[model samples]
Target: MSPIELNKRQEEILQIVKNNGPITGEQIADRLSLTRATLRPDLAILTMAGFLDARPRVGYFYAGKKSAQALGDTMNNMKVKDFQSMPVVVRESVSVYDAICQMFLEDVGTLFVVDEQSLLVGVLSRKDLLRTSIGRQELNQIPVHIIMTRMPNITTCKKSESLIEVSRRLIEQQIDAVPVVAEEPAGLRVTGRITKTTITRAFLSLSESHEL
Candidate 1:
């Protein structure tokens, strides 16, 4: 028999599991305004795709750490590289106020902080901005580098890493987002980004499959 393709509804169901997984079928149905019976097929497909795991009482989770292991298995001894292709980045010199504005304009949660050489020096998030704002500090004088998560310990992902691995890091870190990094002549550089939304979409795509 030919393989089944995921339809739009199946994709939606998959997203629910990825975003708020370990959730109950009933909860999923409720979110979609669907009946349990109506959503069964989508759930079943997601289960088949290895996108979700069902628990007896705890409900369906996003498969938690399994995706990371799967990524390792699939890659075969490859290291989890940093995200270099970050979409939004700002200079360490950029003011918190300006950074906040950029974040809002970009509709992203985090921004990479780059040095004069454009090397990744730190990371800033919406939470950081809010915290800084609470103090009412001088945005123009205060550099984002002061409030950003600095280098070497930054949680990042590479484009080559499997989507599953990326998803795992996002969940485990409990952070809003991650920065992509790449090797540059001067040093490691911020490239792009992979966010919860991206992982959520991937999970949904995996879940919305037809029976084999």
Candidate 2:
């Protein structure tokens, strides 16, 4: 979602905070010759948009912006486990028809295929299903393993990994989502997933956080 542009009063409030941070709302109100109630919404907007940080007794402090390096470092420090969503899975033996149905039911662009042991085996993508649908083969009879992106070719990540690294992989490979896996003795176990939407939500959530 696009951010709300600052209004004239909001801009003035930011300037005041930037110059003398940890300043109380009452002081700011006095300077503006207006009641604190009038400035309430403006203060909330600034804090919500990452422009200000307010403490219990310390008042509002300036958190206008960070340097590019600082911002990158902050993003890199974020973990996948903190942001990933639940994984959507299917059995490799399930028919392409069932996989496609499940994709639509779950509203997901990708599905992870697992074997009997519930270990990662392959992946089914929208394109993979579409290609199969165009063929003469029966969708219900054809197992997903026949059309899914198979082992050694499937991309996976760990919950302990960084979002930036996973995001880079997603961009380079042009894939929609990456399964967060756990390395088992026999195979990888799917625990969660990180998609383009997940990365985007992370940024938005970060802006709402107290950090700048």
Q: Determine the C-alpha RMSD for candidate 2 after optimal superposition of all C-alphas.
A: 10.5
Alpha carbon lDDT of each predicted model: 0.68, 0.81
Tens-digit lDDT string for candidate 2 (1-81): 334456667788888998988899898888889878567656755665567889987889998653222445556657777
lDDT of 1 by residue, 42-128 (tens): 565455445567888878866532222232342332222321223788888888889999999988888888888888888887888
Model 1 — TM-score against the truth? 0.60
Model 1: weakest 10-residue lDDT segment is 76-85
- Which candidate gets the maximum lDDT versus the true structure? 2
- The numbered model that scores best in TM-score is 2
What candidate 2 gets wrong by more than 4 Å, as runs, is 1-69, 210-212
